[model samples]
Target: MTVKLRVTQLAQLEMAALGGIGLLLLAAFFFQLVQGELPCAFCNLIRVCFMLLGSGLLLNRIYGINPWNYVLSGIGALIGSMLSLLFMFAKALPTTKPTGSAILGLHMYTWTFMIFTAALFFCLVMATLYAQRDSLESPGHALDARPTWHKGVIALFVALVFANLVSAFLQNGFDHFMAGGQQHYRMLYDGDVMKP
Candidate 1:
């Protein structure tokens, strides 16, 4: 049997999902800073995917859930999964291991693939439920005032995403180029530091 979610419940779920994403991003940074694991280009791409997914949900909280939001988020997830898969199979650079770190015997890129796949599944489920609605009318709480916790969750999501972008810039420098095989962060002053 299919279950329907009320507008408020849906909003709460979106906020929760965004919070989860924010936390995951924070963890990534933790690994980067605490563990001294610099993110390669592929890792940065995965971070962008998470940010994109969070942005979609943030838009939903602000504008209400819509088909287009799901579409965009799903696309982001797909791209992330594809990149993850590519890195998983490709040979590692001479200076670095094939996988950076492992959690539960699976590498971070593998986890990224799983996360993207799960997000895509969630989008599919939500879209199907929305399609089964009887009326075309909105639930009408799109612009309503949200609880403080909801606002906090949204703020956290925004902060984490912005932090990811800044971290990427610091790691990759201002150059438009990205090196997936890079083993360490590249500083702007490091001339010819592209060697892996």
Candidate 2:
């Protein structure tokens, strides 16, 4: 007997979480490039977490691996969200000493604190959903008809990734792009830096 499911609880959630994160990453990068805000190592790490978590959710949709997919998303969300929060605290703590150029009269840490706070919130939401999610029903319940917002988010994510890719390649020349250089950006961030 062959059973089919489309809009299972987990799948719906994966879509929503991925959409939110995707929109955020896109918005963040565009804001950075347009506003001339630079991403410190920590910011970039958080970005990577968004990308990984987004990817994991996407993979879940296609692969239906269930446990691994949700687990990966949850763990990534937990770790990445926490990492962003810690960076926020570290940056905020040093403000008492006072230093560095303020962008638009605001310190970089100020920007990071806002970003991390939002990311943490989303990560928490995704993690909780993942934990409670047990099964996936067919996608027909809600997704079959296709909601307008869902489509918008998917389009936005594609746009964000495409923009990020092009901007990344052009700025860094495809290698050391985000490092404010042009040789080793694609090599992935160093692990030591990820640890607190």
Candidate 3:
């Protein structure tokens, strides 16, 4: 007997996954603000990759699963993994130690690489499973008839991600540019460079 997920259930799962990613980003921010850890240029790039991944999932939740959504998520994961690998071996920031607290003796970038790899794998599995389904109804069809709580949750996740983008812009600059090995949070406080 083959068990299959309903379109609504699949969308809810995707939304939940995106929400979890948002929470993880929030945790990173907490560490940055409270623990005095600063994100380097590569780190910011990794964050952008994650935001891209979440955006793909958000699209899946809203428009129903499509091959393109998985492709988008996979691309984001691939870029993030490549960035983390570059940081790990290329001495991208030779002067600064790896930012954020280490987990299990591995730097946060290493963990991010692992996370992105896992997300890529998950997207592959989901894509394969979705391909086996007989119906391709839009998830929004069910969502329109459902309770408002799920919509609220999706809105909150979008807002959190938008806030993150704003914070990144404020920290980086109006041009959204930062050189490797430069200072972190440079554009904060009206373009005043803060010592990291």
Q: How does each model score on TM-score?
A: 0.82, 0.57, 0.80
TM-score of 1: 0.82
Q: If ranked by lDDT, best first, what sequence of candidates would result?
A: 1, 3, 2
- Candidate 3 least-lDDT 10 residues: 1-10
Clashes of 1: 0
How much lDDT does candidate 2 score? 0.56
Q: Give the range of the ten consecutive residues with the poorest summed lDDT in model 2.
A: 177-186
User: Which candidate leads in lDDT?
Assistant: 1
Q: Can you list the residue pairs that collide in candidate 1?
A: none
lDDT of 3 by residue, 1-196 (tens): 2244465566667767787778778877886778766566788789888888887887877777778989999899899989988878755467866556887888888888889988889788878878887556555655576458667766876887787777777676776455444445656554444544
Model 3 stretches with alpha carbons more than 4 Å out? 1-9, 91-96, 142-149, 179-184, 190-196
Tell me the deviation in Å of residue 42 in model 3: 0.8
TM-score of 2: 0.57
Candidate with best TM-score: 1
Q: Which is superior by TM-score, 2 or 3?
A: 3
